[model samples]
Target: MGRQRTKPAPTPPTTTRGRRTRDGLILAGREILEQRGWSAFTPEAVAQTAGVSYGTFYTYFESRDDLLHHVVRSVAGEMLAASLVSPDGVDDPYARLVESNRLYLRAWDRASKVLRLVDQGAAADEALRQIVHEIRDFYVGRATKGLRRLQDAGLANPDLDPRLTALALGSMVEQVAHARSAMEEPYDEDTVVDHLSRLWASAIGLQGAPDEGWAARARATAGTASD
Candidate 1:
């Protein structure tokens, strides 16, 4: 033979279940974060937990950070969606803020490790930093817009700065999440939500503890729907 022929490598079979496999991996990764923390996370661990081969993990993600990127995006999406857009829908500013605070607490409680990993990664990786920033900016933009609306409607003080308020609220949420992650004490959801609501309320110029009716209602509804 004057010439030799070479065949291309065969493509790996992955997620014969398609998106379900990737979704399963993400779910498994979240479970790992919750159970083992970031220090214990690895591709091998997640693959074993997901009941998929190591090759399968690579098929869905290039690396551990890649899988974590997906998890953080999903968590951020859920948190943003749960934010209150209008106080009128909740009866008052205090109620609305409390509800929003509660939602943030729930998201943070479940995603604390993921959030911490994102922060740590962002410190070293430009791409990850940008992704984290985009996620924060999206939430802050929505909050600023919502606060502007409240101000225009006379629910928020006319003299209040929406941008600063948005940043303040975001900081408050992140700080509480960081605190919970640092502590080993088992505080319940209601306790966390109550404290978060008070923090947010006091930051926005509210004189006392915020009304928690909206938060209670949202928690009850979320529980019922999940059931």
Candidate 2:
């Protein structure tokens, strides 16, 4: 009797080569968004940049929108993760808030082009809009929790609605960071951080608290600017 034929093993959905190819495509897509803006970004361009066939690009991303969504999620996830790292010796709630905002601004500055593309894409696409809102809500949620803790500790304003205040402050920082990054005239990073920290502290009723570190840095920055 002839030996029965053996069935071959099924191919894995995520092999090493597949992951490399997928990551290359994401990196290429980010580059395209940075150099050409969202309007000019296309699957073909991403494939060319990634040095992969157009078919390979489709094997990973269904469409440009899908690719954009992935890219936004990737960068935003990294930013959020980085922002979660507590600064050394920073026990004050206000200081922690300032540090988190500083980390976020730095992250936004690093990925400003991709973020801008995401912002632009959200205007016309429902999927992108959802992604944008998801990112915003993630930050706002964290802010809300932090504010609630502060209020419970009798630090933040008792009358302020934590959720609404979080949303408003988060929006203010997001818009200001985006605008400052887009400005032709370079803004002082120290000054922006100092002022924003002070504003947030004041809004949360922590204005009179000792923020000596921030004050010292701001003073040094002013002295340097004046010299």
Candidate 3:
């Protein structure tokens, strides 16, 4: 099976007044998601934020979950655009890997709050968990395709399964970035990008794979894993 395009966001009302009201509700929902997260995101709260009657929210959206479907996908579209890199332009495999990681990390950092919310909320909330799964599948699908392309061109490791490798590496970077989002202290962006790029490039048998100091990445494993 191949990847499918993401469905477009729910269209706003065609009339000027209707459009304004619908757009207002979406903005309110987005503000809540970005500021307070899923726990505080109620249909009533959204209506209040948008200065509309509670029933009016329903007129614009079928339910809270329905509104969330639109709002989250809208935000996800921005993240997707931010992370996009033109593979055709980069001739050097290492440079392409580094650029890809850099763009992804940047986009992830911007949505750290929403990412954390989705990750932590997924366990208890099935409806909310779909947001996390959708995001994951979208990224993984693109990455798997990219990996297969590299392998076909003999630029990546032919020994590994592309989908499995995509899942593993995707999880690796996402987990690290999720953890970093929790810290108050700022990290060295350039250093993190270069380090992560090496891990992906090295794993895929891309040229200039790191030869040493790679296994020493477990520096915090003993202490961190216990927590």
Over the full model, what C-alpha lDDT does candidate 2 score relative to the true structure?
Answer: 0.78
Give the clashing residue pairs of candidate 2, or none.
none
Model number with the top lDDT = 3
- Residue range 37-80, candidate 3, lDDT tens digits: 77788888998999998767767776676787677666777788
What ranking emerges by lDDT with the best candidate at the front? Answer: 3, 2, 1
- TM-scores for every candidate against the unseen true structure: 0.71, 0.81, 0.76
lDDT of 2 at 178: 85
Scanning candidate 1 in windows of ten residues, the lowest lDDT window is: 1-10
Write one digit per residue (lDDT tens) for candidate 2, span 1-227: 11222434223247888888888888888888888877667888898999998767767776777788878887878777866746464886766766777888888888788777777768888977887888888999988988888888877788999999989888888888988988743667777877787777777776445553576789999999999
Which residue pairs does candidate 1 place in steric collision?
A: none
RMSD of 1: 11.5
Sorting all predicted structures by TM-score, with the top scorer first, yields 2, 3, 1
Q: Which clashing pairs does model 3 show?
A: none
Kindly report which residue stretches of model 1 are placed more than 4 angstroms away from their true locations once superposed. Answer: 1-16, 82-89, 184-199, 202-227
